[model samples]
Target chain A: MVAQSTGADAKNPIQVIERMMKLLDVLSYYHDPVSLKQLALETGLHPSTAHRILAAMGATGFVERGEPGSYQLGIRLLELGNLVKSRINIRDSALPLMQRLHQEIGESVNLGVRQGDEIVYVERTSSGRSSVRVVHLVGARAPLHVTAVGKLFLLEDGLPALREYAKRTGLPGLTPNSLTSLPALSRELDKVRRHGVAFDNEEIEQGLRCIAAPIRDDSGDLVAGLSVSAPAERHSANWAPLVKQTADDISAAIGYVKPDQPAARR
Target chain B: MVAQSTGADAKNPIQVIERMMKLLDVLSYYHDPVSLKQLALETGLHPSTAHRILAAMGATGFVERGEPGSYQLGIRLLELGNLVKSRINIRDSALPLMQRLHQEIGESVNLGVRQGDEIVYVERTSSGRSSVRVVHLVGARAPLHVTAVGKLFLLEDGLPALREYAKRTGLPGLTPNSLTSLPALSRELDKVRRHGVAFDNEEIEQGLRCIAAPIRDDSGDLVAGLSVSAPAERHSANWAPLVKQTADDISAAIGYVKPDQPAARR
Candidate 1:
């Protein structure tokens, strides 16, 4: 299935595909168009090899010639990316990331979304090794002042709206640690705003604590929350960074971009 | 079997890249996992050839084996697509599509976004052969009731909000044909709701008309408008479908999916 070393790759081996991926990886590293020489050096492919492959990809729009001899990643990747983003379910997208986090921490990871005033558990992954189980089963619900994810949605509502929410919901509590007063809820939400994450502090159950981070969509609007639930003794602040990262990864899977990008926000 | 490339592409093209593209195209065509037999049949590739390539792509996550030997498009495309979508600007994304629409219709194409109560023209392409040039400059602004793009924003506001908008603006008129009354604005918005398109009918200037369709983001929220502006004599209902399609295309570039898919609406 091999042709002359320069001709049709319709039958080329996995090695060619790996070389193509390396070239793509290098192209993505440069913010501007990259020179053929630099691309070849970065990928460790011969200049002629890089040139021929780049030209082939150019034909298929995997790369585009920019500013003469330099090249940039093409719009074709974005087009394909959009198709993938649109076809995937958020729950399905979040599960693997959640599983990775769970396997790392040996704790339960939960994905929740705001439904009315309550945060509804949409998906979760857990390591069976935990001695104390947390009740983050699928379809469970908790009020805004109690769960870490609920507190995030409250903060997103802003202060005045948060005050109104407190008035409406009467700052309900599931346990002694819950923020049952408007002042307590207000202070906790302010911390949520400052830290860009929220904590349940054993509010949803007697001995279980949770740490949650916001998950946003393309327009930078918070659409869901990613959190880790564990026994209060086992839960640590160290979980915050990983939970936040996994949440961000899920958001990116759904087409989110930070405002600093040229894509900007809606 | 491989892609039906012409003789022009037969010489010195990367065969693996061509085969990879063909496999991706075939994978994207089906909503579910495609068997080795079906993929081979679809791409005219041998089953062994298809399996090996799919295996390679799976290693890179561009394809995933689903339910044994059957294959489906992988999340790697989504990951790369997110990278592209997040980095691209709306104006940058819209211009190429706008130029294509202009070339097809031989008229001016415009991209506009709502600012306060007005739609400010953000980008445009014109054939230069127009008998009269339209003032769709980069920063041109028009009231929500007087321009095709503007009416779309008004329609998105719904009836109660539209009523408030009419009250707030007093239904200002720039031309005799403008929708100056609440009843008129309401009726026009109703048509916009029904047809999912809007019109100006020379309301902004004498003999100049425009047709606009809504542009939404990945969340299905209206973010901008895409339209065709030309002399009233040349404007027709036929432009509606193209304008709508182009807007939808731009939406797709930014990670939009129609409601029929499993991704569902937020």
Candidate 2:
């Protein structure tokens, strides 16, 4: 019966669903409630189309209407997000190691995974003293070009995919140090590939700096990024090796044997 | 236009919305991917109806189809959940205090908030020892009758509301210590209300114990619960006062003044 209905009205239903997905993606970018006009503009949907989709979503508690035309991501999302986060085993496995790194370095340590064109923080340990706030809250997302962990993921994409990503996000700059040109970003990524480490020197935020290294799974696939973040004044060249070592330790714990190491006979 | 459309098809649309909400709620309960048959049976929807709704949701990235008919909560929910979690000020304010308490007591500390009929763990600090493998992961949910923090919320509900909750959840028991009868739950809550603390002596899981106290906002509304959890052998009667004090300290940090304290001179 459903297949028959889809055969008759496939075009309209799919279009509506695509528009709704775009509207939801736009809402996810915000940390506060967003107006319908703003959501429409961001999603490139007409106000009426966005409104219709949002009304249906609101009815299901997927979106909450605030004040009048404003909307926010609902509590149901939080409940679901927690469920997703809990199911990801790497987070539980990596947290104690991340905590030890934070304790030793007295800097924020973060665990992030590549999600589409961005990096989503799955876990983090906060640096207690920095008055300059780093907004890498757990579950926070940042574009690949603007963060240390993101840079490592971008480096894995090679130049062709990197150019496509640069085109998609418009190489948006958050600070003067942000790499906005293709040549600059490519050069930075080259350094990252060679050194197995990435750095954000006041790139995302003016006073914040971060150092990141790759975490691999049993298959030796780059599964996550581990980073230590600190204020620019406190940031040191010394932390890079330590960050890379901790990332390697986590990678080994997860069953990745280093490529250069001799395999032991069973 | 939407209002006019709703006027024309009010009943069906609202029913669809209710069914979709029920499907999502059911999916939230299992950390692993669930099958279409299981979801249909659980939600009391026809398999075809469930499939059609899930396909639309999958198009929106609200659900992910895996291994044919199996479905899992999507990453979009995690993205949205993070946004909601970041907006709540209490989680940020409570973390440092919770850290301090964990450091002092060497027990697992959890931060949870009441969401409908269950408690959702928003944040937690894990104990370094005890291989008991507590399943209370972040974003994990437990019924209100089974946890110490949950009992605090039930205590706030008063006797009439408590009776309603007991009926709704059937006073389900996880262990022999669990309150499976309304009379027993009411008696436990009476002690909680009087003493300003709640205890779960292996009610949720055998060989585990928890002590919890309420956290309030400036307006004196109980907003969250802070608790310490440990194994039965390691659990101490002496920790109750300390847990209550730590909870009070967190509450104070979030602007809750004790009722007994005189108002500060402006």
Candidate 3:
């Protein structure tokens, strides 16, 4: 009887799976909780069908029922996400250092990695006192051409790849200070490579400034970047050395020894 | 060939889906990263078949390939987990208060909800300095007969259901202090109901003491329980009032009001 409504194509397994995945996609769009009726309306499925799909998802721990009829993604996903994140040693190793840096600097610190054309924040730590001022949550993504961490990640990819990426994604001006030309960004990246740090002078938000440095893997391959964000007034020119020192400490913690360092540094 | 191996039952759609789900189950067993060869060996599948399943999972964002042949759960899962945790508002609303309580009491604070016959911790905050400990992680489950939160949830389910549950599961002693007899636990539950609080005096772990209070929803239905864990040394006679204040703050935050409250209390 369940198959009665379908004509010739009713039993296609891939289509069934696709429909289920689409239902999950609809549920994932809302950052807040969503009701089954809202899911039904959004997915253009009958309410009963949406309820059935959600029930199936709940059974598999893919979704959890919220207050009554509402639902949200479940902790089974966190178990999986943690597995992926644990392999990224840079993120894991940098976390404690990031926490210490945030405490010392009284600012927010983030670890970002390039994923496709965007930079994804893999980790973040904020001092408990200043946490309210820094609203960027972990897992949020930002454009590669704007933030300090983004620019540091881009610089790590080197000039040729950076040029192609900028050309493809377009170097649009996010703020008055944003580097909108390929030449200017290339020059900035050179400075970043030489100094081993990048700066964001209110390029993302007017009152926010950041300093970032790359984190390299055992092979000296650029793996990720770390950055500290503070209000512009607090990020005076004198703070650069302090930020660089914190970044170096984090880099050393992750086994990135500077070429000039003695072997005893390990 | 794929169809021939399934014999006459080859056309059963649910069996095919179950096979796919079984692959996921095999994947879930590895908390540490898993290699493709290990996965294939564990699942008793041909390497090609395991690879195919993993590839399909990767395409759907359920799993991701780690270094070379290793595979891990993806960020997509974490995104979903965060969504579920957000919808389970008791965890979010109670976490800050739990942290503050932990800071004040210099111990561990836990938030848990009844799931089937067990209690699953939804949130936990701890004072890093504490030597007395509890192993309650988010998504970790504990037996209902032993834990303070578990007993609170069991008591919240009322007398008849409690009798049925205890009859089915039996009150097993986790530690010497744990209530093992049905009559003894029932009496304890009664006491807890009258006082609006519960205590675990080394019932779960020796030398550890905990005080717990139930949390309720706007409908006045018991939703979860909050608890503070401290060393017996710190849980001296005078600690009850401080624990009660923390519990009342959390309960009030979650929309629970005392039954005898004046009309202006809201």
Give me the TM-scores of chain B across the candidates: 0.69, 0.64, 0.61
Off by over 4 Å in 2: A1-16, A41-49, A91-213, A216-266, B1-17, B91-213, B216-266
- Per-residue CA lDDT of model 2 for B1-266, tens digit only, reads 13222123433434555566667877876667999999998877889878888887876557888689999776556555655655658887688888888888788889989999999999998656546646478998999998999999999888899989987889899999999999988999989988889999999999999999999864478999998888898888788888898888777655455655412211
Clashing pairs in 3: A77-B77
lDDT of 1 by residue, B1-266 (tens): 45565334545768877777777777766767889899888777778888888887776667778587898776666555555555667787788888888878888888999999988998888567666676689898888889989889888888898888888999878888887999888888888889888988989898988999988875578889998988888888898999999998988766566767523211
Q: How far in Å is the alpha carbon of A98 misplaced in model 3?
A: 20
RMSD of 2: 22.6
Q: Please count the clashing residue pairs in each candidate, in the order shown.
A: 8, 0, 1
- Sorting all predicted structures by lDDT, with the top scorer first, yields 1, 2, 3
Model 3, docking class? incorrect
Which is the better candidate, 1 or 2, if ranked by lDDT?
Answer: 1
Pairs clashing within candidate 1? A8-B15, A9-B14, A9-B15, A9-B16, A10-B15, A81-B81, B1-B44, B1-B45
Give the alpha carbon lDDT tens digit for every residue of A1-266 in model 3.
24332224323334334445556776666656689888877666678877766666566555677687898665445444433334547776688877877777777888888888887888888556774476357898878878887888787678789889888988878789888899988888877778778888888777888888777653356777788877888776565666677767766544454555412210
DockQ of each: 0.33, 0.17, 0.10
Ranking by TM-score: 1, 2, 3
- Give the candidate number with the greatest lDDT: 1
Q: What are the Cα lDDT values of the candidates?
A: 0.79, 0.79, 0.69
Ranking by DockQ: 1, 2, 3
